[model samples]
Target: MSMTANTAMAASTPRRGSSIAWSDVLLNIYILIFFLYLFVPLLIMIGAAFNVNSTPSITDWQGFTLDWFTGEVDEETGRVIAKGLPQEDRFLQGLWHSVIIALGVVAIAIPLGLSGALVLTRLQSGSTTFLYTLLISPILTPGIVLGVTTMIFWRDIFSVEAGLFTTMIAHSTFIASYCMLMFMARLQRQDRGLEEAALDLGASNVMVFRRITLPFLRPTILTAAVIGFLQSMENYNTTFFAIGGSWTLVTEIGSRMRFGLTPVINAIGVIFIVITVVAAVAWVFFRKREKG
Candidate 1:
C-alpha cells in the first residue's frame, strides 16, 4: 500500500526540467525576436552603405565601394576618387555645429545639474519639492514648446536670434534635468561619513567641495557629459524651432531625407554604428578589466 501511494505521488508531480524548459524557451525566443527587430534594420542600413547604389536600398546589390563615404572628384581624370573627406559640405558643417552645440550643452547642463542636485539633496524643507519640480519642469515640457519659447525669449528679451546659441540653450534646458537625476542618484549612494569627517577636520567649504564632493561625482560627471552630448547631437524638434539658420548633423539628415535620399546617408549611419559599437565594446572591456 505504501509503494502504491508513493508511485501515485510521483506520477502526479511534474518534472522540473520540463516545467522550466518552457519558460526558458519562451524567454530565449522573446530575446531573439527583440534583437532581430532592433538589428535587422541597422544591418540593412550598413549593407546599403557598402553597396554602390545611388538610392539607399539593400534589395538590389550594386557591388561594394566606399566612394559614397569619402569620395572626391579627381581634377585631372574627372572621376570620383575615394579616401578624401565626405563630399557633403552641408552635412560636414552641420556635424561641426552639432559638436559645438553638444559641448555647450555639456558645459551648461553639468554644472546646473550638479547645483540643482546638491540643493535638492541638502534641502530639508517642504519648498524643496517645489524647487525640484520647477527645475525638472523643462524636461517634462514638449521639445517644440521649449524651442519656440527659447527662440522667442532670446529674440524679444536678449536681442539674440535663433541660432546655435539658442539651440544649445534650449537643449540645456531639458538636458540639465537628466544630468540632475544622474547626480542625485549618485549622491544618494555616497557615504556621508567621508564628508562629515572632512568637515570635522576643519576643511573650508570650497576645499571640501573640490576635494571630496567633486571626486565622488567624477563618474557621474563623465556619464552626464556623454548623455548631454548625445542628447544635444540627436535633438530635432527643439533644435529645429530654435535654430533659424544654423543646423546640426541630425537636422541636416532630416533635410536630406526630405530633399534627397542617398547612400551617403547610409554611410553616415555606418559611421554612427561603428562609433556606437566601438564605445560599447570598450565599455564592456573596461568593466571586465575592472572586475578582474
Candidate 2:
C-alpha cells in the first residue's frame, strides 16, 4: 500500500510541473506581444529618421542619410539642398516657446498647489471638502472650456490677448490641481507631532513650516514641478485655443502633419526618446545610490 501511494504522489508532481510550464509559456507569449506592440512603432520611427526618403516612411527603403538632422544647402545658389531641423525656424521657435511655457507653468502651479494642499491638509473643518472640490474643479473641467474661458476672461478683464501668457494660465488652471494632489498625498503621511513640538518649543509658524514642513515636502515639490512642466509641454487643446496665433512644439508638429509629413518630425521624436531614456537611466542610478 505504501509503495502504491508513493508512485501516485510522484505522478501528480509531474502533472503539476507540466501545468506550471504551460502557464509560463503563455505568460512569456503575452509579454512578447505587449513589448512588440510598444516598440515596433518606435523602431519604425527611428528607422525612418535615417532614411533618405522625402516623406517619412519605412515601407519604401530610401538610401540612408543624415540630411534630416544636419540639413543640406547649396552654397552657390543658397537654396535648400535637404531641408533639416536647422531650416525649420518655426519648429525651433515653437520648441523654445514650449520650454518657456513649461517653465512658467511650473512656476505658477507649484505655489498655487502648495497653498491648496497646505490648507486642505492642515485646516480641519467641514468646509475643507467644499474648498478642495472648488480648487480641483478646474482639473475636471474640459480643456476646451478652460481654454475658451481663460482666453475670454484675460482678454476682457486684463486686456491680455491670447498668447503664451494665456496659454500658461490655461495650463496652470488644471496642472495646479495635479500638483495639489501630489502635495496633499505627501502631507497626509507626514508626522504632525514634530510640527506641534516645534511650535511648543517657541518656533514661529513660519519657522516651523520652513524647517520642518518644507524639508519633508521637498521631494513632492520637485515631482510636482516636473509633472506640471511636462503637462504644459504636451497640452494641445487648451494651448491651441488659448495661444491663438502662438504655437508650441506639439502644435507645430500637429500643423506639419496637416500639410506634409517629414523625417524631421521623426528626428525630433528620436531626440525626445533619447532624452527620456537618458533621464530614466539617470533616475534609476540615482535611486540605487540613494538606497545603498
Candidate 3:
C-alpha cells in the first residue's frame, strides 16, 4: 500500500513541474516581448547616432559620418564648416543648466516634503484629510495651467523676470507635491515606536527626530529627491511657460529639430540612457549589499 501511494505521488509531481515550466515559459516570453517593445525605439535611436550620415529621411541611409558631433554644415556655402556654429558644448551647457535647476528643486523639495509628511502623519482625522488634499492638489493640477498661473503670479506679485529662477520655482511647486506623496506613503509603513521610545527616554523633540525619524526616513527621502530631480529636469510644459527667453536642453533640442535632426541628439540620448542604466544597476547592487 505504501509503495503504491509513493508511485502515485511521484506521478503527480511531474504534472506539477510541467505546469510550472509552462507558466515560466509564457511569463518569460511576455517579458521579452514587453522589453522589446519598450527598448526597440531607443536601440534604433542609438544606432542612428553612430550613423555617419543622419538625415531627415528615416528610410534613406546616408553613409555614417561623425560631422554632427564635430560641427554643423553651412547651408549657403555647402561646406562643412567647423566655426561659429553650435557644437557639443552648446548642448552640454543646456544639460548643465538642467542639472543646476534639478539640483535646486531637490534642495527645496526635500525639506519641505519631509516636514509636510511629518506634519500630516501627526494630524488628526479632519485636518489630515484637508492637509492631504491640499498637499496633493498641486500634483493633480495640469502642468500647463500651473505654468501659466506661476508666470502670472510671479509677474504680477514679485515683478521678477521669467527665466531659470522662475522655471525652477514652477517645477518645484508641483514636483515637491510628488515628493511629499512618496515620502508620506513610505512613512505610513514605518515603525513609530522607536520615535516614541526616544521621546519617553527624555530626548528632546529635535533629538528624537534627528536620531530616530530622520535616519529611518533617509531612504524614502532619497527616493523622493531623485524622483523630484528627474521630474524637474525633464519637465517641458511648465518650463516652457516659465522659461521666457531662456533655453534648456529640451527647448534647444525642440528648436533645432526644425532646421534638421542630427545624430548629436541621439548621442545625447544614448549618454543619458547609459548613465541612467548604470545608476539603476548600482542602486540594485547597493540595495542587495544592504540587505545582505
lDDT of 2: 0.93
Candidate 1 vs candidate 3, TM-score winner: 1
Q: Residue 48 lDDT in model 2?
A: 97
TM-scores for all predictions: 0.87, 0.88, 0.79
Q: Judge candidate 3 at residue 268 and give its lDDT.
A: 69
lDDT of each: 0.91, 0.93, 0.80
- Report the C-alpha displacement of residue 255, candidate 1, in angstroms: 0.2
Sequence-dependent TM-score of model 1: 0.87
Considering lDDT, which of the candidate structures 2 and 3 is the better prediction for this target? 2
Model 1 lDDT-worst window of ten: 79-88
What value does the lDDT take at residue 7 in candidate 1?
92
